[model samples]
Target: MNKKVAIIGGGIVGASAAYYLSTLPGGDQINVTLYDDGVGQATSAAAGIISPWLSKRRNQQWYQLAKDGATTLMTLARRANLSTDVYHQTGTIVTRTNEKDLHDLYVLAQERREDAPDMGEIKQLDEQQVKQRMPFLTRSQPGIFISGGARVDGAALVEKLLAQAQQVNLIVKRERVKLDDHGKVITSMGPQRFDQVIIAAGPWINELLKPMGINVDVRPQKGQLLELSIPDFPNQENMPVMMPEGERDIIPFGQGKLIVGATHDDEGQFDLSITPEATQDLMTSAQAFVDSLSADNIIRSKVGTRAYTSDFAPFFGRLQSHPHLLVASGLGASGLTTGPLIGRLLAGTLIYGGTPDWSNYEKPLSTYLS
Candidate 1:
């Protein structure tokens, strides 16, 4: 018998899960329908950074998840025939303002390189080398360059996934879904019964599960970002992503275009308005690294709300209270890097029912329910 599966949410996590579920082995036997209300989608707002080595977090679980996520993105890029402009392996330059900070970054880089050999050519760049490689950077601070670091276009990736999913007979509906107690999915068109439902809503998962008396510890993390265009900057496309050991990053988007951003604010609201304070802060931080982006060069600012968990880890697996419901969310800032893997993990569990090794991922809400 064919199992009818309904996926709530259309962000990266949900989209990736839907794509994998509709194409994985034995997936053809499953009928999939994806419901997206098109509200609070963090995937499109994501910075799409894929540099796991730059993170100083030494937790094995987090590291493994990020590593697998990066690997999965590469595999998907190739499999999906995504253009190079959309996904760039442009590498990353991790910099620090002071000598002590630079030294600390070097030590962490050494440790990370030794632990993950596949990171590929983790080396320190002198001030001159940094300038030569990334001329847009104004400061002469020492930086660490990782060859494998890359960036992605989150919005483009989602579109590709949706197209592929539809190609494989997965139904895409832009409707808000409500789940009744009996596992009936309520949509605008009508109520539909599904054998299973997966909640991949980024920050709105809590609202969807509230009727079921389930509250996953997900908070809205507002990240305000800036998009800039540095016109006539020589060889800007080849310049790598620059990080200043802060909450901000400068990502190059080819053709002298740059994305400087992300002010982390936890106001717990869906307000997409950019605060003047955040814009100034981001611009000030970005200017310290890249001199060209003056006040006048500012293109525009945008906002994205990420699903942040209490433990700062993603939730994956079936909810024990509701056996037919599975969830994957709370990816925080690492969603672009880890969302794909989370989807694959959930899809694998659904396709093959057995004791699976989920040690590397986050604990599901079921762990707390019991």
Candidate 2:
């Protein structure tokens, strides 16, 4: 008999798992069912920045995962025939107000590149060079350009992934599901049993686990971003993603579309309403780089809840106590960068028989869950 697999959540991680497990070798032997409530999914609301090479974050494991994810995701995007509008390798322009700090980053990229050539070519750019690449940018900060950086259309990618996975024994549920007990998964439609279950449900994973007396160290953070349409801007599609030394980043998509903002509001709780203050804050930040940017160009605002751990590091694996259950969360804001690769790792563990060495990828899965 074929094995039955149930996946909770339809975001990047879950969708990627379904895509890989069903489309990869030996995929026809296992059936996949995906459940998604569609309540404030972070991936859809994300700006989709995939430039992990220039990040100053010191977590080596995260860096390693994101670095590899960059390569894997872009390769998969090409192989999957995702259009340039869906995902594009536009590279990235990292800016710093201080020249010394900018130069230090350049040196670091070069050193890291020795180990990760996928980080792509590194080049320092003067203010004029930066202006030429991103004409809308008015900031005088120097920049370091990493040629391998890319951008993604998170919502579109998930749609394509699920559509492809459905070609070979994949069922998608558009409603919320529940875990009634430690090993039993109960759904609204009816009671079901599966050979394996994977929970990639963002911050809400805790809610599912709580019924079984398990509360993983996870919390929900609300994120807000804005979309702008600048029709007259030249080379919007060819422009590199603008990543300043702060929370705000500017991503250029095809045809006059620019994605901006994204605040990590811990106090926002689960509220999905757009905040006027957040819009003002984001516009102000964007104005710092583009003085010509006007609120009139605003298209829409995106709000979603992101999952984070106490230590801010992501962990994924099967629990020792429940061998049939696998869980992954705590991706925070970098979900767009690390999610798909993590999903592949989970599916590979089961599809190929036995756990792969994940020592360098993360700490013990026990660290995130008890």
- Estimate the TM-score of every prediction: 0.93, 0.97
Writing each residue's lDDT as its tens digit, candidate 2 over 160-275 gives 98999998879999888888767678888677899999999999999888877787999999999999887647667877887887648888886788889688899986889999
Q: Which ten residues in a row are the worst by lDDT in model 1?
A: 361-370
Query: Lowest-scoring 10 consecutive residues by lDDT in candidate 2?
Result: 230-239
Show where candidate 1 strays beyond 4 Å.
Answer: 367-370
Colliding residue pairs in candidate 2 = none
State the displacement of the C-alpha of residue 330, model 2, in Å, after optimal TM-score superposition.
Answer: 0.4
lDDT of 1 by residue, 241-337 (tens): 8776764888888776788877778883577787888889888888877776677887887777888777787778887677888887788889888
Top of the candidates by lDDT = 2
Candidate 1's C-alpha lDDT? 0.79
| lDDT score, candidate 2, position 168 | 83
Instruction: Score residue 2 of candidate 2 by CA lDDT.
Output: 88
